[model samples]
Target: MSSPPLPLPHLALIGAGITSLTLSLRLTSLGIPHTIYEQSPSLTELGAGLGFGPNAARALEYIDPRLVEIFNQTATFVGTPSPQGKELLLQEGKAGDDKIWIEFLDGTKQPEEGEELKPEFVIRAGNNKGHAAVHRGAWLDVLGGLVDTRERVRFGKRVVDVVLPAGSKGRVKILLADGTEAEADGVVGCDGVKSKVRQVLMEALGEGREKGKCGYSGKYAYRCLVPWGKAVEAVGEDRAGVSSLWMGPNRHLLTFPVDKQDEKFLNLVAFVTDESQVWPERGPASLTLPATKADALGDFEQAGFSDSVLQLLKVTNEKMDKWGLYDVADRPLSKFYSGRIMVIGDAAHASTPHHGSGAGFCMEDIAVLGALFEEAIARQRLTVDALEDVFAAFDNQRRERDQWLVNSSRRAADLYQWRIPEFLKPNSLEKMKADIEQRQEFCWGFNVGAAVREAKKHMSERLAAYK
Candidate 1:
């Protein structure tokens, strides 16, 4: 066969997070030219754990099967019957063994002495029964290792501004914090929630800088990676090994295991909502404010959490840091792209962790963008207009689904914390169960392949208009 067309429109990827790395892998597979710009001095990601639903896993497979393989190699699959299967076999839980996504319990009540606590409801695992999870740093290292090289990823080059092309034929200019400039045919903002490229894109779209800022969801969490042995010692192995959620009034705690080559740990996030308190500005001190172990115990104690749950919290650091959850719900962008600059991943639609699907959604974004760029190369449309068409098509096909995640995530927070008004009515348990089941199915049942085909069709129509 003849050689494939050379990749068109040299691209600049802002931020070297998962979004950038995943997209880099896809572009590399297609021989596209691109660079990852990160503000950090090195490739290090700080977070406790990252979880992926089946939909997210499918997105990885769609981008490249190797991605799924890499993920499976490093991730911990909780309560999965078969780790390497394509079909999810739904089965009821058995004593000492649970086969479910999460067992939701009433955190506000403690079981009577000698009484076994029963789950209010359970959400069966989606496809493959693989609730794949891993430490943020571990997976970041793996992904970064695959894509990061001195020539491909540039560090300490924080983006200060993105100057959009004045005409369809000109290049987009990127200004860095170190007083340097780089030009590319297009810029994809894969930066996190505090993305400067997003700010620049917002201003270019005539939306004020405030439009790009992430808003606090009135929730804060205490995150820790406790040793798996310690968790098993505190709670029995059966309970500790399985993923679960303890739901209470205005608070909820989630736990899952993350196993790597060297160690296995339990990832825990205890969320509390205090609308009365105003979120402090972003800074080291504000982001991870110190709190005594007593403070953590106090928060869960009043909620009537069992000794097993409290012991898990106690196994954490004597002094815990409170991490406020923030998202783009308050000021969602009217448009995802302005000229040749488009925002993707968290930079586009950061959401609360209530849904635990943010990272998966990022992969989905990469899959769609990858398909569009492949189409662009095949068509040999190398002009700025063609790139614009690609961005427009991406925005048209992706904006609705992504923005819905942000909204639904907030709604899920309410449901988990018993803050929804419907919880006060009769049959509240039934309503909550139905809502959770429906949402989980919807989130995990997305069709990434169909999305790719539709987006390609849309991009082709847009490209034909320019012709």
Candidate 2:
């Protein structure tokens, strides 16, 4: 029995960041032609470093096994803490059997070593080593280079509006900022946190308040990247691989390595409470200090922040990059697709960086999109109507997961905050471990290829109605 030929979709993907790049690679592998539009006149690395977990690493593995190999070789994975610190927090794995061990700064163990540690709990110190930290620009460059030049990732093309053809089953038209237009069978909106395509999708659903509403998490971040040589000289070489997190009243500071060089670059993130919810804001370059160098360190110095963090702050010639940390607090959207247009990544569900899953979630989006497109084309099921069903299924399978991440990240933010009560402190480590285990089951357990298969099954039933 001869199989029916697959339908070919002319796909248009907006944004060339990590998510878009991943999708571009996947589309290339499936021989599905696509055009990518990026708003930045030129593509450049925006942030310093990113921490990727097993879930994100697995998603990348599905995209290209070589990517995983490269990441493992070039990146640093911190799994076990050195004898330098005290143990304060613990995290357990999914079965509540495996435990992460940690020593906090004060040398106090919420769960002392040799005690019966459950797999469900996480030692805050132990969980620290479970992530692979890499430079943001370096990681993006790796993915961007993999994209074929023939695919034409067009820059300087900010999407202003999405034009649907007169009839429901018409070509998807994308309006560019420069007054030009491009047409395709469907559009994938990976346009990031402030997405224009999302606005169009919301309007189509007649959800006005949802489209206009923006999240305000009452948190802000200050980020700076410092050279490795300077960091090691200030913080010492032994502290290079370990990420130091100092928790204080209503604030915290995180410092970690981004590269593998002896004098590698270190990325610093300072999270503080700020009532304002604006984006693209700049933080103060310098704080008031007395004559002494210690005085100049201010609150950060008093908190026992590593010398590397202080050095980065002192040497930063420009104001640190500051932005509001916002997440969608409302329930997840019921729909993520309309007509030939669909939303992916942060555009669909923005979340806090507490769990370091922003890029991970985006990668997951790309993997799922690639798989669905492959099946639809293979089954000869690709069409305007067919794509709608595929998009709906993609939304159906993904919305709940994305929303879960959003809520989980919010909870993590609360747990990591500096002001936890004393009584709560003893149980925090055990609870933290348990939370990690649950997170692994929910997040790391996701299978993009399987999800696509399920989506395909659902899409097939829907497509039969139109036949």
Candidate 3:
């Protein structure tokens, strides 16, 4: 008699963000069949700069080193913008309301002197040491293009709910927005912070209404982009080529460069930790709220930062949007799986952007998950009925590490805003520089390939228990 087909012959992915795409890459490599559902009409990314470290870059080797290649090709070193075009950028201000002055927290102005700081002053806030930066839109475009089965990605199909079939070997049924339904042997939630699949799973497990909800992390970011020529003219050439993180009490500002096509753009992000400030939208955990340049300027003035930073924001094109930093730590998940359903990436361990390792951590999940699936298929030991092993192995391997990131990012933010009492002394700046360097080592030291190997081993050990 012919052998029965594998249990997970078909899998369904909800959401087409980076996590979904990365998982698709791995499953396709193993010749696993799956389909991706995206609520967005098209694959597009908003926001400003994105980055990951050297260790996270290596994780791409598991899927395709070409991902790292695409990143390197499009990425601009933080702080470096084209100097030859600085004059033109300053002249071609988008709104024609460009301010020509800069101010600093040190009570001195740029192009004027007041306690000059070295370039390393940028990373003194305990940041990713090997960070490589890229435009959010550009990186998304590259990853979306690299999918071998683009046709498998379905757009405008929002997943509303998911339920497992009554029988053990039956498929998991997924309901979509248009009242249509799809079935798969397994389902993975890559739906990000506001995940519908996660909602379904949480509701099923009786985890309570508030157990898995995302909430504001008591911080908001004023994210904007300025033309290359203008940023150089405003911040000057020397400061333009080196990335800097200005950390003050309860606030921090960072600047980096994004290379898109032939033009280089400077990405400016200013984050504030204010309990009094509220997002314009009082509705549920919305992605972002509309913002104005004047709003950002007013916030900066209160932040007590230099006017030089304000000069760059003044010339940025379009209305600056203030993104409330909403993370999952409000209801942190102690477990990443339930039955055959699993939540990955932001849906599982959403973190603050303080470490700049969020994207990197998502990729690591894909690597380890792929490894587990690959091993099971090879052993012919994985079937829909054996999903206990899949869920157990993934959570056992990933739960603490990913959640640690959630907690670590919160701690890092506290340090950056000087909320931590240990970093509050007069000599605390120097102490922070030393202390954070060691603390940040784990952020860059994680090896995704090794992580996958370890997960695979745990999966086998767990599966054997059933026999």
Candidate 4:
């Protein structure tokens, strides 16, 4: 008699964001059959500047060094050591006075007469200290070029619903908005903040009705990218090249460099908390509304921001749009899996961008997922129950860290805006500095390797028990 046919593994990936693309790279490397379904007619990324912490870079390394290579090629580094070399990365005892990550300054008050303005504190590059940022759309374009072969990714296919299989060997049926259906062994939801897949899983698990929705964050930002030369002239070359954060009451502004095509640009985001009006409920469109340079300057007119910050804002287009920030903190998910379906990236644990590590943590999620799938396929555990085991293990390994990010990010925003009650008193700068240091280390020092190993071990145990 002929030998039994080898089991084939296939997965459906929802969304074409960085997380899904990174997972696609890993799955392709492992020879796993999968397809990416994107709701848009073509892959695109909004927002301006995006960065990776040390932990995120490490996660990419674990997934495949090539991902890091792509990152290096796309991202812009501040001080010495070009992106071609790895010297200015997250290293120990390598942080110098010149290798700065971000310089935090007070924007609420001007300096005293004859006193030069200085940073309240600086987070340098060392001891898991790295920050490399790029234009979101540019980075997405590069990653897309690598994974999207036209055949592997199907565009304009929105996942309306996912139907889980009743039996272990049966396929999960995915219903699309365009009146089509596809089947796969498993589905990974990477559909982002307003995820339809998350809603499906929430309903399936009988979770709260509000758990899947994104909360308005009570804040919004005016973002733009100015030409490098204009930024240098506006804020001086030092401020133009290095990442800096200006802190004030009810608002803050951050600036960093990003390359667009052959020209370097300074990406700026000015954040303001609106206590006067609640964010209006709107559909999942741009998440932005029209504003003018006058509107932006008016928001900060009374904040006592430095001349440089005002100049940076003035360089933006005459007409601009302010993006409303949103996250899942209002209703954090306690679970990430239901049946063979799982949520990753923003779909699972969307957080405010205050920490600047959302994408990094998402990369960490992809690393854990890739490792578990690798283990499952290696052990011939292609059945639905086995895949479910893989997802369960992933949840156990990732839930704490990812959810902690959602909460910590909110706190970070408060700290930047000087809204934290405890740190409001005089002589509290030291306390605030300590808090920032500890939090940064906690996120930058996460052990992706151990997480991967632990997740795979747990999946192996589950597969053994199932047998």
Candidate 5:
């Protein structure tokens, strides 16, 4: 039997970051026409390296097998090389669940005492190789190239609002910052963490305009790269290539290599979690400001961080980027879509980098949404009412897991700091491994194929209601 035609020939996509570009692949593949409206003057990503595991790797492969090839050839650097898939999963998390080598710095005991600082005990690690770490911009570039989305992507169209268009039954109107507007049969917002599209969706749900605004996660990151030779010089030839984590009372530093020559350097993010540390960008705006190496070194001193880790820090690239981290958990939401507008990626759920799965989850969102859209276009059931069903399916399938990411990431931060209810015994090596394995299952074991199939099954039932 011939499939139903898509209800509309043209669709609107807001924000052309990684999520939008990835989604564009699916839409383009199914012959579903979409135009990406990006607020940025150009399509690029600014950040340090990111990891993607099997679940997200499979989703990218599903998006387009070539994307994986491109990512592997260009972006897969550092971390373990999985037989099937791998990606960076988190910065650092859990009390007894750390993936990299743990080193106890000066005065491993609590900070309240005036005792002399010295190393107490350390758990020998650095053998676990279990994901891919790619520079953020290089990874985005690979995705952008493989997805073939540039032609349809329109940059500099800042989205101000997304709402149901007047007199355009079930269609959506995207208000631009320049005061012009564009209407489409439906809007798929692959926007970002501070998404205007999400606000619109929340507003429609009567959750108030500011109901689920993004907020700081009480963590800021100082990230930089170290030239490969210099890093190898400091950390030794063998240790420099793997994941190395240095831990202290309240701060930790992670080091990993970047295989791609584009960033052929050692990528490390030094995270400081001091109660007294206030965000310099105290407004609603989140800043990824330029950080001096001196400022980062000061943070190390403030945290009373050890010199063992400082050796790796001193050899880093001249550039550093500091930013306050935010997540969607603060301003909780009850739903994922409204009317013809559906939010995906950071637009819908922004989790902390503690999990390293935010973008992976975004890929999962694209996998489900794209599958349903493919089915809709094939079944000739694409329509206003039908899209609502699709959006509902997306929400039903994705909300719980995606929201879990937000909470889990926050929980991970506590676990990593040993601030949780559970206590780590003396030299708890096996216990740490066990805790890490238990907590990591959800991330590493998530089957994108199974998710796509299940969403399609649920979507089939929902589409019947509209018919």
Candidate 6:
């Protein structure tokens, strides 16, 4: 007799952000049927600068190698450092010599690079390699286009509730805002930090509400896009590519380029401490500061920030468009899965942007989830019990990596928050150079693809044993 037909996996993904979009594409490639319910009526590009690291770039490659090529065509790589470009400042070593260095807490050293490495206050700056800064919108457009409309990515369908049915092999039901409901073999919540599915899981598990909280990062950010011509007139045309980071007491400023076809826009971001933990509910046009331009600029002016950085803030015509920066911690969740429901991306862990790894982490989630599902289907083990096992394994594999990234990102923030102090700071520029050199491996050495493959191997063994 002929073998029974293989069961098809039906996935319901909530939210249509980059994480959801990438997951949709991966599901399609694996031939796993799925549907997406995006709350937004239409996908619009939001946010400012996005720094895609090598790991994130690799994830993009897995989805579509052409994405990398398309990104490179419009984006310029930051290479050499210029006076008009971005700068990193360091102080002289304890030896009181003309050279400066970065002293690590672990007793490592990094030397200064160029003539800017003066003894009094050294500035050893170089271009950030293997990293590309692009407009948020441009990146979204590439990922969004990957979604096949025929695959059923429904827009304007807000997920109101997730109903977990009792008993084995029962389907999970997703209630929508339009008084409609859809049942699926499984549901993936990529709905971001404020995830309704997460709420349901927490309540069902008796975890109680307010158990996990998301708060502002004690920082307010001012972001704007300035025309290249306007920026050049202020900072000089030669300073276009470098991502300048200016550090001061309790505040910082970052500027980078976002290239389009014929025009290049300068993305400027300034962060300062705010007493309130709530983010701005409006945009830049609604922000009103009692402080003058000088006060708002603060110590950034003393750090020799470019005129263009100051100009962008001054020229902003509206305050409502300005947004505040907020972040969530690595909160303990009761679980990542319940019955036929699971969560991924920011819905699982919403971290601070200090390390620029939010998008990277989310992409990693998609890769891991996709790999597990692929193996289950290949083995003809696509039942509710099999999926639950997959979810458990996926979470176990990801927990450590996510926590490490979160801690590392927080440490990076502390390092960049202050200038080199006398006596306590590095003694020589060569010594400072050595300190930074030691950290190179740790910063760029992550391999998400390898981790995913390994996790799948381990998980497949566990699933077989359980069977």
Model 3 Cα lDDT, one tens digit per residue, 1-467: 96985655678889888888888888888888889989888886875778765456667777666785676567664422233222222121122222111112331223347644443232331122345677888788787888854577889898878997665667899999899999887888899987877777776677964666776788888887778888888777656655656666677777766677887777788787857645555565476878888887777677666667677667775587778887877677657776778899888888888778888888887878888887888777777777657776888888888888888888887887778997787866667766566655676667666787897887777767766
Tens-place lDDT per residue, model 2, 83-152, is 2211111112222222232212221112344442122222432332245677788777788777774356
**Sliding window of 10 residues with minimal summed lDDT for model 4:** 88-97
> Which prediction has the highest lDDT against the true structure?
4
Q: What ranges in model 3 sit over 4 Å off? A: 1-7, 77-129, 148-150, 277-285
Candidates arranged by TM-score, highest first: 4, 1, 3, 5, 2, 6
The models' CA-based lDDT, in order, is 0.80, 0.64, 0.71, 0.81, 0.70, 0.61
**Which lDDT tens digits does candidate 6 get at residues 1-467?**
96784767688988887788888888888777889998878676654667664456556655655665676565544432232221111111111121111111111112234322112222222222245566777777877776775456798899988888877767889999999999888888888766776677666667754553444555666666777777666555544445555444455656667776566777766666554656554542233233334545643455454444455455432442334444445354657777677878877766656666678777777777777877777777766567778888887788666655655555444444443443236455355335434343243345656767876796788778975
Deviation of model 3 at 358, angstroms:
0.4
Return the lDDT, model 1, position 174.
Answer: 88
C-alpha lDDT of residue 315 in model 3: 70
Give a tens-digit lDDT track for model 1, residues 1-467: 97665446689999998888889999889787898888889887765888887778778876877776777666777777454332342121111222588889887666777787678888876434346687888888888778745789889998888888666778889899899999988999998887777788788878888777887888888888888888888766877777889998788999988886779888889998866656776672145666766887888888777776787788887877888788898889888898889999999998988889999899889889888877776677755567778888789878898899999999998889888886768768878888887887677777777878877777677666776
**Clash-forming residue pairs, model 1:** none
Candidate 1: residue 362 lDDT (0-100): 92
Query: For residues 293-331, could you state the per-residue lDDT of candidate 4 as single tens digits?
Result: 888898887777776578778888788788788888878
TM-score of each: 0.93, 0.79, 0.87, 0.93, 0.86, 0.79
| lDDT-best of 4 and 5 | 4
TM-score of 3: 0.87
> What lDDT score is found at residue 173 in candidate 3?
91
Give the C-alpha lDDT of model 1. 0.80
In candidate 4, how many Å is residue 169 off?
5.4
